[model samples]
Target: MPIRSEWKLAREGWTLDTTTRLLKATAFNPLITLPLILAAKYTARGAQVASQNETLFRTLKSLVALGVLGSISGFLDDKVVNNWKGDEWDWKKEVVVVTGGSDGIGKSIVLLLAEKGIKVAVLDVQPLTYEAPPSVQFFQCDLGSKEAIEATAASVRSSLGDPTVLINNAGVARGKSILDSTEKDIRLTFNVNALSHYFLAHQFLPSMIQRNHGMVVTVASLAAYLSAPNMVDYASSKAAALTFHEGLAAELATQYKADKVRTIIMCQGYTRTALFEGFAGKSLYPETVAEEIVKAVLKGRSAHLVVPESSWGIVPRVRSWPLWMQYGFRKGLKNLMKSWKGRQVVQPSETQVEKEKKGVEESAVLVEEH
Candidate 1:
């Protein structure tokens, strides 16, 4: 059997993020540097006694200094980002709403939350793929419609109380060039992948602001940073989603005075799911992505996750590179989806305009009789 992508990520000393992980461990946890400091001192003493090797002594000393500096820099970064306040997690009282929770990464998140005895409301167009526990409740929803989202929000509030966590995990991808994609395809892609964030935020975020508590997790993709030839709509929406997450975090702190209300955006690499069924490159296991999301939620802190961790350095810095370099890199992605056997085109039951009108009519009575 072939080595699974998720397992491959965990390979010792060889994974994409292995070096990053080690550096992070050294930087964030000073204890990791203790051994390195000791080794430096030992090496310095040996070099002096054996050969008086100044180069060998200097190298070890430099490593020790770099380690210490990294640790301090990491500490300051954490404190500044979090505003020096720590998270106070109370999982028992929290209610989570996960969109697209019927299957794939969303399903895994639902199960994990349920296992922890958390109340989870699942909003998806499809039915649950597996039998859900009592803690999990499914709500059929077309995420592409703002009106549908409004109606569903009312249902969730009534059934599960106000949600404390909202995971915007539902998404649709139409692997087509700009010319090949119909207007409907483009609309549906943006509606679900990007616009729903606004609708959902309108419904639930006010409550979070009032209580000064909540979390919003946006599941974007690596494509958010790198645009491929066939994924124009997908990339654009994800980029919007990424910015939405950043702007939301800023607004929570600066505008709403709700620093405790955390925001997380996940820029995940390719994953093994219906979304990327025939993707040629290595794709992560959906469970792997879900585990990272759940873990971040449990910590009760704002985070920006670039999964496979190796892509962390490369993805975010793409735009900063030279024009030719950026062009060359994206040019390489032209054939990324040539083998794409995923949902090439998604046709929604109702058009966006119709859904909006119907949503308004259903949710609020238009002409009230006196």
Candidate 2:
């Protein structure tokens, strides 16, 4: 995955006065840095501060304290979203189709669904080597392409019948800072992570609407709500997908009068999975937890799941904090984001055979060795 950096340096064109206003009003702005910030504002702040010797030592001390606090808060907020501990999944009589089910969260979801005697279709570009249960079937498709998805959808319907549950879990994690990413990277992320849901839902949803029942589950990320350095394309694409999911749920209830078409989302945190790299050593949570969460949601619950079963509460409110705190916390999170580079891009065309041959490795060893 490539990095996207165009937005990071696009120059906001704000005047010195405007930037000064922002600095002064941000929460907990220290008196020591206010004048320096005001004088320098956007363009000249760095040079102006470098030349200033008038700031009191105590005030500088306060600014340093603020930096430490911000970093701590950012990390706390990031870790707060993973606290999802849940009950067992009852998957009797359910019909589910999971895209990108070759491995990772998608694979886990299929495995658990099969365990519960649910009929599951695993859609992927790779041929499956994982033994499917008597109730599980694998369908190969390039989910990023509309034509391919539509063709595959027809085959699935003809072979296994229309699925009552659609899990849009096919995703490629691109950890490149935006500037380093190719246009192809950006397009593939949006197509698979954002737009592919629309394609899949359209192909299978009419039957769901007619039957007065269906589940549409999407896997977004905690990054959608909080973006830092390194994952611009991946973060923003997930955000778009989240917004799309919200809008469609509203439409189903209002214009379409299809309240029976249940919509659920998983805004996952760090998990022990192959899609994420660079984050190898983090002890977040088992990926199996994510799979079970998917199963529980499929059984008839509307949910928002964050992995690791610990960070669930803090995630929703990470954005509601005052400006200074948000910036400081975000700055602190920069240190953590540096480790995001190891997450490999799991494209539709890439299989485990290719992954192993390409010499790509897991981001980190599993938190639980089984």
Candidate 3:
């Protein structure tokens, strides 16, 4: 049998961040330097020693210095630069609302939070793939519909109290070029991926402002920075989402005077999920991405997280390059997606059938009232 793409990448250490971490641990570790220093000292005392002893001693000293410098730099980067700290709000009091929690990275996040004993409410059109504990509640919601989101928010508030954390994770990607995309496809993509964030924030942010404590997490993609051929709608929506996150964060600090209300925007690379099944190139595991988001939230800081960390500088500075260079870069990216075979349609589970039935009944009642 052929090896799976995710497994093959993991085994070969294709992820740049993972490879860099391993190299640091083995090659730049101070523990490794200590042994080398001792070996050099012992070898120098032998009769066979020549200029090799001097060279070894100098190399060991340089390695030790590098190791110590790296340690200090890491400490300062985490503490002084990032300013990461423990959670400020009580975990018991935190009620989390995660949109699109039925599958993919959203599902991973919901599970992780539930495992930590936090109250989690999932707002998704689909049903849960796995059984969840009492801490997790599912609210069937079509995020593309503003009316559906408003109704779902009321139900969530009634059931779980005011949500202290809002994760706008719902998104749709129609793998179609501008000319190939239908009007409905474009609208649905934008509504679900971008406009839903606006609606959700409007519903939940005022309460967070009043309390002066909350966390809003936006899960975007690297496509926000680089557009490809078949992902025009997807990339545009992500760019909108990224901009919305930045604007919201700025408003929280400057206008609302609520800096404690943390905002996190995650621009992740392609993730290993059913959504991107036949997409080529290196991709991150959903679990790894979820864990990073959870860690950032718990640390109580506002940040823009870029997966691989290597893209942190490059993605933001692409526009600064010459127009020809920019064109070349985008062309290269477009060529990569020429072979994409993303999951065209997803089958709804039995739980989804039940949820759809319930949603129809509730929607009828809501429609009657209007």
Candidate 4:
């Protein structure tokens, strides 16, 4: 099927709102689909009516095609070609620890892992809204504090065995510009987003290093590349994370010579989480799925960069662009993310308090020297 611009928006709108179901009957409405689509009619009324008609026409075209071909061919071919029998991202045997697990993407992961019979631990100042498994222990630990992380590590070690996988998922969105941001906001941004990875690694990596097995997943964002104006704090922190993942992966493979200590860096787009509720759109693909993030974390791979396919070709590999295009390109991005009010997305204060408490907990955990 030809994915025209209007068609994509039409598809997304239909997917979001099922009220357009009657539009499916117009499957073969070629006359309705012709004007602005098949013919170049520049009038506003012609273009608007043509777009509305085109949407209905293409949607039915898709629904009818699915009824005819997709249901039978795709389903049966899948039965013969692929193994349907498989453990679907089983987290049962893994002791998965997720930071910022009380809210947003992190919270979703905690709930999902718990359902899989995984021994999961939730670390966040705030509690998870969703009910987790009985085995899923909730520890209020702040990732930003070394002291709190140490304390929480002790609690986690006592309650659960040495963690098999550590998800460095705790983060904050200081969606402020460099000029607008206060000093505290800047420090808190890096502390929560970037430095916490170090504290958690110190607590969890030794066990993985000793056993020569573990996965460390870092949740970064695509904003690291775009570096949109309003997200200066968020961007810089994520940029640190992306770079740190590469270096950490190299160190695990070269310095420690333990490739088994796998690492993953999740560079995601917008998700339908409380943290991003104010954000306009929800991403269906390319953005990291909370469930998929759990799966990737468990696979214990070396590296994973989740990017939309369209974004790959556009990434700036060369030093400069054609001069005429630079101004508009930069301006367009700012306009696209302009609704993103920086002040709305602030770091959670309880996150730091959790860190302080975790430090208290870590003092109780014992670490045997190599």
On lDDT, the candidate that comes out on top is: 1
Question: Which portions of model 1 show Cα errors greater than 4 Å?
Answer: 1-14, 22-53, 344-370
Model 1 lDDT tens row, 124-192 = 887788998989999888787888899999999999999999999998887789998867668878999
Residue-wise lDDT of candidate 2 within 260-320, one digit each (tens)?
Answer: 6677777877666666655633443434444545555655745556543344456556789
User: Against the correct fold, how does model 4 do in TM-score?
Assistant: 0.65
Q: What is the lDDT, from 0 to 100, of the residue 87 in candidate 1?
A: 65
**Global CA lDDT computed for model 3:** 0.76
Q: Whose TM-score is higher: candidate 1's or candidate 2's?
A: 1
lDDT for position 233 in model 3: 88
How many clashes in each candidate?
A: 0, 28, 0, 11
Candidate rank order under lDDT: 1, 3, 2, 4
Which prediction has more favorable TM-score, 2 or 4? 2
Measured by TM-score, the strongest candidate is 1
- Whole-model Cα lDDT of every candidate shown, in order: 0.80, 0.66, 0.76, 0.63
TM-score of each: 0.86, 0.66, 0.76, 0.65
- Alpha-carbon deviation at 200 in model 2, angstroms: 0.8
* Superposed Cα deviation of residue 17, candidate 1 (Å): 2.1
lDDT of 3 by residue, 1-370 (tens): 1213332345325567666667577667888876766665577553244244677567667878898798988677545322343337788889999998878889889988888788999998777878977899999887878888899999999998999999998777757679977666678788888999999998999999888889899999988988878888899999999999988877886799776688889999888876676676678888777877887777767767888676776876888899999989888876556656554222122224435655422221112111
Worst-scoring 10-residue span by lDDT in model 2: 1-10
Give the 10-residue window scoring lowest on summed lDDT in candidate 4: 361-370
Candidate 4 local lDDT, 240-343, one digit each (tens)? 98888878877876688665677777777675554443454455432235655766565545546554323433543311667556555655556434554322
